[model samples]
Target: MASQAMKITLERIALFQFTPTHCAQARAMLGWSVEELSREAGVSVEAIERFEAKREVLDVTRLTLAYRFEAEGLVFFPGFAPGRGMNVKGSTPNPMARADFAMVE
Candidate 1:
């Protein structure tokens, strides 16, 4: 008997570019075996093995999956806060705004 073809999604496609280091973190942090990571991520064990054993980078298309991996709170890069570089979300405070306000024609 033949196996049915598997379907791939954009998110799954993005993880292809991930470095083996990233995948190893994901597996270790999530307490998952290679098979478990493959099942949860909808990727194949072969791909996971390639990354883990060979340390080869996955394809570029797989990069997008990094966010998804982060969403799981697995092994998103450390020291990277989503808003680290961006301004705070709340309204900005500036008492000097009114004092510095000047109308120029």
Candidate 2:
């Protein structure tokens, strides 16, 4: 039962998708550069650049990048709504955390 529950949780998490815009916004919000993100995500700088430019990346690469950003306190929202967006995970003084924004492209 526990294993099944874990599988279900993982499946739900796998459904979340982040766009190129989201990645850029989150990086900007955290004041991180592409090189920084690449190092943290364990992906090549070229991969990050390509993903940002094309908004498409391998599923595993996307997951790695997303998790890396999330680990840095950026929370990604995966829906098409005004309130669906990224923000810092906690109540920080960062202005971006207080903004309700989304990137659709």
Q: Model 2 off-target regions past 4 Å? A: 1-15, 79-105
Error of 2 at 12 (Å): 6.0
* TM, every model: 0.45, 0.61
lDDT of 1 by residue, 4-38 (tens): 12223532433443456666766666678877765
Taken over the whole model, the C-alpha lDDT of each candidate is 0.44, 0.59
On a 0 to 1 TM-score scale, where does candidate 2 land against the true structure? 0.61
Q: Please write out the lDDT profile of model 2 over residues 1-105, one tens digit for every residue.
A: 999798557635743656677777878877789988766556778878888897566655665666566556666566632122355442222322322211211
CA RMSD (A), model 2: 9.8
Task: Write down the worst ten-residue block by lDDT for model 1.
Answer: 96-105
What is the clash tally of candidate 2?
0
Candidate 1 RMSD computed on C-alpha atoms after optimal superposition onto the true structure? 20.2
The residue pairs that clash in candidate 1, if any, are 13-61, 14-61, 14-62, 14-63, 15-62, 16-58, 16-59, 16-62, 17-58, 17-59
Per-residue error for 20 in candidate 1, Å, reads 0.6
